[model samples]
Target: MVIAVPAVALFCAYATASVTRHLRVRSTGFDLGIFEQGIRGYAGWGAPTAPLKGPGVHLLGDHFHPILVLLVPFYRLFPGPSTLLIAQAALLAVSAVPVTRLAIRRFGTRGGSAIGAAYGLSWGMQRAVGFDFHEICFAVPLLAFSLECLVDRRWAAAVAWAAPLILVKEDLPATVAAVGGYLILHGRRRLGGATVCGAVAAGLLIVEVLIPAFNAAHTYGYASGSAPLSGLPQKLLTVLMVLLPTGFLAVRSPILLLALPTLGWRFWSANPSYWGTEFHYSAVLMPIVFVAMLDSPPARSRRWLPAWCLAFAALLTTMLPLHALADPGTWRPDRAATATRAALHRIPDGATVAADNRLAPQLTARCEVYLFPFYPSAALRPTWVAIPDAPSNDPRSVAAREALPSLGYRPAASGEGVLLFTRSPDR
Candidate 1:
C-alpha cells in the first residue's frame, strides 16, 4: 500500500494539471516560469524572463535560490515545462520512505503502515503535489528526511541532511538553526552547536552578500509594502491551519518549533500572497507536523490516536482545492486551454515570443519565452506575442493586449478568446 502512494500522488498531480486546469501555469507570475527560465539560463540558453523580473536579474540574482542550478543537467536531458512538474511529484513522494521508517520504529508493522498512509495522504502533501512546480519541492523532502533522522536520533545523518537546506532558499537557514536548537535542548551539544553556527552564518551570508551581489536590484527586495504586518489575528489563523489538521498532535513535539521561521515569514510578509492558505509556501510544514505526530503517541495512550489523526487529515484534503480538482464536475474541460494551445502552435521553434503568464509555461520549451508588456522582454524583440483574453485584473494579459499595437504588433490570429500578434515581417 505504501508502494502505491507515490503512484497515486503522481497520477493525481499529473491529472490535475492535464484535467481540472493548469493552475501552475495559469496563475500570475508566482515562480514556475521564473524557475524554468532560470534553468534554461543555467543550461546555457538566454534568460529572457529577466526583464520582467526587473533590471539585471540573473537566475541566482533574482531570488538567491541556487538550487535550480542542479536541475541544469535534467533540463538538458529533458527540456520541457512538465520536467519540473514531474520532478516535484517524485520529490514529494520520496519523502514518504523515511516517514514510513519513522512510523515503523514507533509502532509495529501494521500500525506503522497506517502512519505511513496517513503521512502520504495528509492534506499538505496532496495540496503540495497538486500545486504545480515549486522550489519548495526540494525543501519538503529535505526537511522531512531531516526531521525523520532527528526523531530516530541519527545525529550525524540529521546534520548531514539539514546542511544542504541553506541552498534551498534564503529563509530555510532559520529552520536549520531551529533543528540545531532542538538538538541542543535535547542534550547533543557538540553537533547541535555546529549546526546552529553554520546555518546562521550561511543564512546571513546569502541574504546580505551573495544575493545582493547577484541581483541587479541589490537588496533583499521582497517587501511589497511598508506595513509591518496585518495583525495577530491573521498570524493566529495561519498557525491554526498548520496545527488543526493533525489534531494539534504536532505541537506535542519539539519539531513544532521548526515551523516558526517559515510561519513568521508568511504571516509577516507584506505581499498578501504569502498571507493566505493558497499556494505551495506551506508544503514544507506538512512533513514536520506529521513526523511530530509520530513522536507524540505515548506507548500506552496512543495506538488509536495516529489513525484518528490520519483519518482527519485525509478527510481535510477533500475540502482543499487540490483534491477537489479531481472531481469531474469541478474540472469540466477548459475552452480557453484549447484556444491557448491553438495560439501557441503558431509560434515556430526557438523564436522569441512574449506570452501571458498562463501561456508562458507551454511556449517556454520551444521558444525563448517572456512575459508581456514587450519592452521588459530583455530586448529580444519577440517575433511573436500571445495574449489570452484574461479578466480585467489579470494585468499581464490586459496590458499586453492594449500595448501590442503601440509597439508595432498586428493581430494575426484570434481563437476562443486568444489573440495572437505578429510583427509585419512575420505576417
Candidate 2:
C-alpha cells in the first residue's frame, strides 16, 4: 500500500503532463510519431514498419527492441500517440515500487516514502517524462526490480527480471552482463557465468546480425562515428549530476558499478545529446544509484540522507517540466498552437503528408505522415505538405520549402504561422 499509493500518484502526475504536451502539439514526430507508427503496425499483426523512418523502414532495423510488442495490446485498446505517452508515464512511475519497497525495508515508512518520491521526481525521470517516449522507459523498472531481487538474494528472480533487457535494446546487454558480474562477486559463479555469456552473445548477434539484416543499408547504422575521449569535460559533469541527488553517497556501494555499461556507451557515442543530462537516456540510472544509496547504509547520525535527496529533487523540479503543472498558462494553448492545429485539420484522412517536425504527431493517427524533406520515394511524393509559416533557420527546412514549388504544391490552408500545401491532382 505504501509503494502503490505513491506510484499511482506519480503515474497520474506524469500522465497528465505527457498527455498535455501532446494535446498542445509539443510532441515531435521523430520519436512519438515514429514509435506510434511502429506500434500501429504491430496492432495490425504486421511488422513494425514505421513509414516515418523511410518508405518501409522496419523499426527493428533502426534498433533491436522486440519488447515493444508488449505495448501493441495496450495501443490496440486505446490507439494513438497519447497511448504511448501514457504508457511511458506508467512504466516510469511503476519503477519506484521496487526502489521504494527496498527503501522501506532499510528505513522506516516515512523515510521510504520520501526516498520513493525523490526517485519518482528525480531529474532523470523528469527529463524522460518531459521528453517524448523511448524504449528506455521499460528498462527503468526492469533494472529496479532486478536490483531489488538481487538485494533480497533471490538469484533466479533477479536473472529472470534482468534477462529481458536485451530485448529492450542492444546496448542493454552490457547492463545485463554487469548484473551477472555482480552475481559472480556474490559467489553465484555458475549462474553469473551463464548470464554474462548469454548477454554478450545476444548483444553481438543483435547488433552485428539482426539489425544489419533488417537495415536498409545491410549494416549497423550506429556502428561508428564515436569519439569517446572527445567530450571529457561534459561527460564528467554528467557523472557528477547523476550522483548529486544522493549527495554522492551511492558511490559507497559496489552496486553503483551497474551504471558503468550505460555510462560507457553514452560517453563513447559521438552524439553530444547522449553525454548530457537530457532526454530519456539517464532514466535507467536513477534506480541503480538510489538503490546503491540504500545498500550503502548511511550511519545513524546521517539519517537525514533520504530527506536531503528528496529536497534536492524538489528543488530541481522548478527547472523541469513538472513546474509547468503549477502554472495556469500551461493548460491553455497559445494562439500559434491553436492555429497550427486548425491548419493541420485541413488535410484529409489517409492522405500522404510531409509534415513539419512538430506538426507530425498531430496527424500521425489519421494520416500517412513523413518528416519534411524526407519521404518514402520521389515517385510517391506526399499529397500534402504541412509546415509553419514563420521562417525557419534550419537548412533542411529552407531547402524543403525551396523545393516545394518545383515539386508541384500550392497553398491549401493557412493559420497564424501555419501553412498547408496540397499537390495538384494532375501532377
Candidate 3:
C-alpha cells in the first residue's frame, strides 16, 4: 500500500507538473512574483521587507537547511514561475513518505499508507502546490517527523524534528507550544528539553514579530492599522472549517480525539484566508486521526477500514481536479491570480507601487512595493501606489484600500479591477 500510493502520487505530480507547465504561458495561478521576489531578496536586490514576512522570514539562501532554501537557487537557476509550481508539486508528493511513516507509527503500515495517500492526492494539496511555493508544504513533513519522534518518545529526535516546522512560518510557534505541552503532560522528561527548545523557538518568533512591527512603526509611523478583527463568530467559524474533518473522525473514532485539538488549534487560528484555499494544512492532522482510528479498532474491523478510508479519499481526490478542470474559477485555477499577474505586468518595472495584496509585491519586483497593514520600517520604499479595484465593493477590500492612501499615497495607474498611484515624492 505504501509503495503503491506514493508511486501513484509521483505519477499524479508529474501530470500536474505537465499541466502547470503548459498553463504557465498563460496568465496563470502559478505566481512567480513571490518566488521571484524571494530570489531577488536572497540576492539583496528586491525589497528587504519581503524577507521579513511570513515564509520569507526563515530563508537562508543556500547556506542553511538546503531543503527550504533549495527553492531559492532553483528559481534563480530556472528563472520562471513554473519552476516554483513544479517544486511545490514535488514537495507535496514527497511529503507523503513522512506522512505515511507517521500513520504507520500510530495505526500500522497499511493505515498509515492510506492516510498518506489521501493527503498526497487531495485537491487542496494539489491546488496549493500548483499555485505558489508557500512554506506550508515544507512545514508539513517536519511537523509529521516531529510527531513521529514524539510518539516514539525520542525527545531529542522530536526537538530536532520540529525545528524546521517552527522555522518555516511564524504561526508554527503555537504548534510547537501545543505539541510540547502535550509531550510534557504525557510524562516525557525529554519534553523538558523540548520545552526549553520551544522557549527558544518562541524567542525567535518574538524577534521575527518584533522586527517587523518595529520596522513598520518606524517606516509608516504607526504601530499597526485596524483591519476588522475577526469577531468571535468569524473566529469560531474559521475554527470549525479547519477542524471539521478531524471533528468528524473524532466522533466516529474517539481515541483520535486528543490529536484533534492538538493539531486542530493550529488550523482554527490559521489565517482565515487560508481556509478552503490551502487544504494541505488542514490535511496535516489526517495521519494522527488515521493512526488513532486504525489502532483502536478491533482486529477484524481494522482490516477493511483502512481500505474503505483510502477508497473514500481516492474518490474525493479524483473528483477535485476534474471539478477544477470543469470550473477553473471554482477549482484549481483562480481568476484573481491571472488578473493580478496581468495587472502587475502592465505597471512599469522599478516604479514604486503600494498594494494591499502581498501578490503584487512579489509579481512587481521591479517596482517598489508596500503591503498594507503597513509595517512602519520596511526596508523597501514606495514611490507609487496600487489598490485593488472596487475596494468599496467589499468591507475588507475597502478597509485595505482606505488604509493605503492614509499613509500618504494618491492614485497613479488604474484598470481591470486594479488601481495604481504614485506616492507624493515630497512625503
Query: Highest TM-score: which candidate?
Result: 2
Residue pairs with backbone atoms closer than 3 Å in model 2 (clashes): 389-417
Error of 3 at 109 (Å): 7.2
User: lDDT per residue, candidate 3, 1-427, as tens digits?
Assistant: 5644763665465446534533433322123454445555554544323422432342332112224455666766765545655665665566566556655655676666766666565444555544445556666656656665655667777677666655564545555665666566667757655665765566454445544443433232222333334344654564443334332443454334434443443334435543333434554554445434433445565456556656665666555542344445443665555675677676677665555554453443465444533421235446655555653555656665566556556776666566766556665
lDDT score at residue 322, model 3, on the 0-100 scale: 27
lDDT, candidate 2, at 284: 90
Candidate order by TM-score, decreasing, is 2, 1, 3
From the highest lDDT down, the ranking of the candidates is 2, 1, 3
lDDT of each: 0.71, 0.88, 0.52
Runs of candidate 2 with Cα error greater than 4 angstroms are 333-336, 375-379
Supply the TM-score for candidate 1: 0.87
Q: How close is each model in CA RMSD to the real structure?
A: 3.3, 1.5, 7.5
Q: TM-scores of all models?
A: 0.87, 0.97, 0.61
Give the candidate number with the greatest lDDT.
2
Looking at candidate 1, the ten consecutive residues that score lowest on lDDT are 18-27
lDDT score for candidate 3 against the true structure: 0.52
Name model 1 segments beyond 4 Å from true: 1-20, 23-29, 45-56, 223-229, 300-303, 321-325, 329-336, 374-381, 390-400
